[model samples]
Target: MTPLRPPRSPLGRRFGHLVGAYGLVALTVLLFLAFSLALPDTFPTLDNVSAVLSNHSVPAVLALGVTLPIATGKFDLSIGYGLGLAHVVTMQLIVAEGWLWPVTCLVVLLGGAVAGTVNGLVVAYARIDSFIATLGTGSVMYAFTGWITDGARIVPGPHGLPAAFTDLYDSRFLGLPVPALYVLALTAVLWVLLERLPLGRYLYVIGSNPRAAELVGIPTRRYVVRAFTGSGLVVGIAGVLLAAQQQIGNPSVGMDYLLPAFVGALLGSTAIRPGRANAPGTLVAVTVLAVGLAGIGQLGAQFWVTPLFNGSTLLIAVGLAGYAARRQLQRRRAQPSRPVPEPPGTAS
Candidate 1:
């Protein structure tokens, strides 16, 4: 019997696969060039670069926090409320109770971790759907935030915030804002974890197929819980940075970051390693967003346009991610199967 072979994919199919994989990156570069051309005086300058870096760093960090849960095929909606709670707690400790800044920062970070563990327990052990569980937990966190602030901002006392604390977010290093360095450091850490570590492999396996991961003896529930816990820790750090930047605790500030963070994470799934959420892709997505927003703002767009842009871009990102995932799946399906060997010495 003759060995059967799958037909070669058409040139158009191969080209479409390549485009699906790299289209977002190309789009980002093109957008930057277009903006530079349109606003040559402002968009292409170092000062604008610095401003975008400083302004978007917090959202970028927050987006990374969400990306972890996303990688595990879970959603964490409580990050926004958790961020507000952590920062507000930091302010209350430092300004109201006169606690040391370092101690306050530590306590706030631990609190965020605890909140994350609770979310994990609810989602993993209690068997609640992640979206609903996180939404409920986030609402509770919001209530706690309101209670802490009494619906008011926590302004610093007579001494004001320590210069060292404020400098964490406001200072520059090597001609670039320190926050940008923080983003780079975090991205490196996450990339190593997700791409190079055993723990990361397990998480990816779980995300890709929970049932198969469990059958393979991977601790699906435990790893999912851990993912949420890790996300919480990152959220805590972001909250501390947020406090340092604002120098005040506003209970309502955290929700503003949620949409942008989700936008970056989801948008990122379409680029770099398509069909998966990865650190490099998230960073790229954030850069695209930051540049677009900065260019539009410099163009004197109305206030409502920013939110509208973000919302619309999010929808487009989701659509693109689905398209990319589908393309990848189709490409895999179209690949030829291995050739079967002939019987005994009758091979071709």
Candidate 2:
């Protein structure tokens, strides 16, 4: 008689599945290596890494903000303009009004939350399509931003901004830029909220099927509003940090971040937790973008190269996300349904 052998465990099978699922992360690694090889001296250094982290942190935050709304099947185009407006408001309150920095920060953040609430009400209560609603609000925000600045920058008085205020973005914690820490902390908070909380589940359910969520008594409208509000609040936080980082309200800086932010959020859905927007996945996506951009810059790429890269990546991300979703659906369909068990004495 042949000796009995144990069957393979699910762990081995899951390892293969996880590798396939995390292909984007693998691609990121490959891109990093390619850059390091291409620019051996400059690309693999700590200074380059620091620059990438410091520069991308704001986009990372904005990406996280948009991720929340996207999770609920909504989009907030206003985040870019809202970021500019919030920072402009912060500066106006500080330089023109001479308000305390801390107090000004609070007011700016509150304004952001209020902006979010308005967006929520428009999309949820008014029953407008989120894309159109946010686009309208975003345009209005840009108008307000331009009106506030009159097409000029908001510079601080000769005394300069408070050390504490500037420190929020410029200071280092554990040998890394403080804004990077903010990114990590926010990612952690969002991960917990989305992956480990009831609210997260509700949002995903609504995104997956609003009608089914309504049938299951999930208060879809209220939750969608909350999602947009949360996004607004996060965008406000990003604006504040942007103010700290720039130390001047440029009015035009916010729009530059919009494409990259959405790209990160959308591309992220194809990895880690495929077919869903998740925090860890977004972080990974942002890292890939940062690495690729930094490497390209070091290679003496032209200024226009940056936007070209971003736009192309956005298109690719969308295509990959759709492909991954279809693949997931096809795999599910391929699995055999449970066969009806034979009645007693009916088996062959």
Q: Against the unseen true structure, what C-alpha lDDT does each candidate score?
A: 0.87, 0.88
lDDT score for candidate 1 against the true structure: 0.87
Give candidate 1 regions above 4 Å deviation: 1-18, 330-348
Error of 1 at 339 (Å): 21
Worst 10 residues of 2 by lDDT: 338-347
Give the per-residue lDDT of model 1 (tens digit) for 225-323: 888998898899999999998899899999999999999998988877788788888988998899899989988999999999999999998898777
Model 1 superposed RMSD (Cα): 6.8
CA-RMSD of model 2: 7.9
Q: Write the per-residue lDDT of candidate 2 for residues 251-347, one digit (tens) a residue.
A: 8888988999999999888888888888888998999999889988989999999999999999998997777667766665778743322222333
TM-score of each: 0.90, 0.90
